[model samples]
Target: MKNALLIIDMQQGLFHGPHIPYAASSVLSNIRLLIKKARSSGTPLFFARHTGPDGSPFSEQSPLTQLIPELDVNVEQDSIFIKKYPNCFRDTVLLQQLKLRNIDQLVIAGMKTEICVDTTCRAAFDAGFKVVLVSDAHTTIDNPALTADNIVRHHNQTLAGPFVSLVSTEEWVA
Candidate 1:
């Protein structure tokens, strides 16, 4: 089956913000590794960038909307989808792009585990895509109700059986 990598909202705004994602550095490392592996394997890479209204961090006019500099994003090799919502498939060309590439499976990773990541995983599943969530490659900041770690842990458990197959970066790479 053809597989692709879908990295959502790994943008400069999120990383440069006051409350950074939990395990941000390690998650970036894992995402980088996944990108490298996907490149080498000829798996297409799809990036979903969230855009917000003017004055917001992810506003189109804001530099924060740009992908983080640490990621090895090649414009010629990667497909980028601009989104306004948490679900990447919502009003986005992500599904079309994947279908064009004959990609039936998606390896999803990126920022805001409890929001975009969780939403995208389920959306992908509902859209009939086989999704594998890189458990250690997606992260988010802590909320008032829960720590970031617990949020990640909770989503992983909740999404595993019905929404996605879970794999760590090491397992995915190897």
Candidate 2:
């Protein structure tokens, strides 16, 4: 049951937009706590940053491509995988890297719950890695049809099952 913590797209660019994701502050705090625990527990930590072609918010050179300042991502220790599409695994060495580290179970958390978070969770499960979705550690902005709160709630329920295990930061850290 070797495990690794996977953080996706908690980039500075995500905060620049007008609509902050639901519970953004709480999510950040929880993720920071998770990072702290991982560091002390000797758990491996990995980050996936989104980088899109020119004109996208995640441009190659954009400062937003970097993780938020508050996150304690040590380049020498934690590995970072960059993705251009929704699925973080595609065109990325994430799977291979995880395999190299002998990681079979992944504890995943990060921003935009409906997009990268959801996509990566499904993909990781399909790829045969057991996944834990840190329930309150991910978030998204409200859409026209649903509030961000509802979106997070919907995904938390819908994504739980054979594909993913939904748990809070407390449960995950323990």
Candidate 3:
């Protein structure tokens, strides 16, 4: 199975503000590790950036839509797909790009586990790609309905069997 790494919405806007994702530091670190591993293993990396309406953090004119500075994104080497919805495939060329490269397995990680991360994971599965979700490399902010920790846990459990194979950053990297 050919492998590719799909990083969803690890944008500056999502990391800042009052509602920082749970375990932001560790999640970022894990994602960095994944990136390193993918580079070393010759796995292609695809980054998804979410766009929002004007006045929102992810607006086209907002710097928040930019990828986090901590991530070493090479415009020349990495593939970036701009998305306007929670499901990265909704209006993006991500699937086409992956197909062009003959990628059949996707290792997905990034921000907002309950939203973009979750939606993209399922979409990738429905699109017939074998998906591996980096369990510790994705996160979300706490909501009134559930703590961020619980949200991550819930999505991981729910999506594992049906939508993805669950792996850790260490496992994937090693």
Candidate 4:
């Protein structure tokens, strides 16, 4: 199957606020490795950046809206989608780009496990694309009620069970 890597909303804004599944530095490392692998294999890479309304912290020109420093992104090699909502495909060109490339499978990684990541995965599945969710390659801050670890674990198990194929970075790289 033709595959592509979709890195969603790994922006600095999400890291600054009190969020759940606190953005782990390690997730970036794993995502970087996946980017390298995808590049070497000649697979397509798509980046999603979330943009909030004017005056918001996540506004288009805000530094926080930028991708985190951990990812070695090359504009020449990657296609970037600026999204207004959690679901990357919502009114975005992501689906069109994937369709143009004939990408039937997606390897999804990035921030906010229960929100953006989960939403995008479902959208991709609904769009008729097979999804491979990198179980440990995404994260969020701790919620007031649940620890970050537990939240991550819950989404990984739950999302993987019925929504997408859960794979580790090791398995993905292999």
Candidate 5:
């Protein structure tokens, strides 16, 4: 099965101030590792970024709309997709790119584990792609009721098996 690494919403906005996900450092580390592996293995890498209207956080003039500087993405070397919706495929050409790359399996990692990450995982599955989440490479912010840790754990457990398979950074061979 051909696989592509899909890094979703790892933008400057998400890492700033109160929007930072839990275990941000570790999550970034894992994402870096995954990026390195994908590069070495010649696996295709696709990035999904969230954008908003003129006044929102992801406005064109905002630095937050850009990918984090720490991410190892080269504009000339990788593909970047922008979506206004939480579901990466909703308003983007993500699926088209996947089809062009002949990718049927996806290795996903990114921010807002409960939102974009979760929604994309399920949508990818429903669209008939094999999906595996770099579980530790995705994270969330604390909500009114639950801590970010709890949300991560809950989604990891709930989203496993059916929507996506889970793999830790250590166990991720690809």
Candidate 6:
């Protein structure tokens, strides 16, 4: 089972707004750990950046679309996809890239638990790829009705149910 790592929507825009997810700072260490493991294991790492419509702050040319500095992303070694929709596969070359690499499994990590993260996981599953959602590697902002931790826990426990496998960064590295 050849696998690749998908780091989705960990953009600068997400770091400086009210739209930012809660406790995002807390997950950086876990994400960094996953990145290191993926690199050491020779797993291909792909990054997804959200691009809004023309003139929007997060548009293709905007700095806001850049990967967050916490990850210290190296664009030269990583594949990058600029997506307009929540699903990384939508209108993007993500699927083609995976297919070209013959990747059958995906190790996913990133932000906005209820949106981009969930969307990509479901789409990947639907595309016939096995998905591993690194529980500690993804996070979201706090909502009025529920804490950020609870929101992340809920999705980690139940998003797309059996279609996706939920595991921690440690387990993945192990």
**Candidate 4 C-alpha lDDT tens digits along 40-136:** 9999999899998989977899998998777778888899879998898999999889999999999999888878998998989988999999987
Q: What lDDT tens digits, residue by residue, belong to model 2 across residues 85-140?
A: 88989999999988998998999999788999999999999999999999989988
Per-residue alpha-carbon lDDT of candidate 6 for residues 68-168, written as tens digits (9 for 90 to 100) = 88787888998988999999999999999999999999999887788999999999999999999998889888877988889888998886467689888
> Poorest 10 consecutive residues of model 2 by lDDT?
12-21
Worst 10 residues of 1 by lDDT: 53-62
lDDT of 6: 0.87
lDDT tens readout by residue for model 1, 1-174: 789999999998886678878998899999999999999999999988899988876688788889888887999979987999999999989888888888889999998899999999999999999999999999999999999999999999999989899999999999
Clashing residue pairs found in predicted model 4: 20-140, 20-141, 21-140, 21-141, 21-142, 22-140, 22-141
- Residue 145's lDDT within candidate 1 is 100
What is the Cα root-mean-square deviation between model 5 and the actual structure?
1.2
Q: What are the candidates' C-alpha RMSDs? A: 1.0, 1.2, 1.1, 1.6, 1.2, 1.5
Superposition TM-score, candidate 2 onto the true structure: 0.95
Candidate 3 local lDDT, 1-174, one digit each (tens): 999999999988887756778999999999999999999998999999899888986687688888987889989999998899999889799989999999999999998999999999989999999999999999999999899999999999999999999999989998
Off by over 4 Å in 1: none
Q: lDDT scores for all predictions?
A: 0.91, 0.90, 0.92, 0.87, 0.89, 0.87
Candidate order by lDDT, decreasing, is 3, 1, 2, 5, 6, 4
Candidate 4 lDDT (Cα, whole model)?
Answer: 0.87
Residue 82 lDDT in candidate 5: 85
Residue pairs that clash (backbone atoms under 3 angstroms), model 3: none
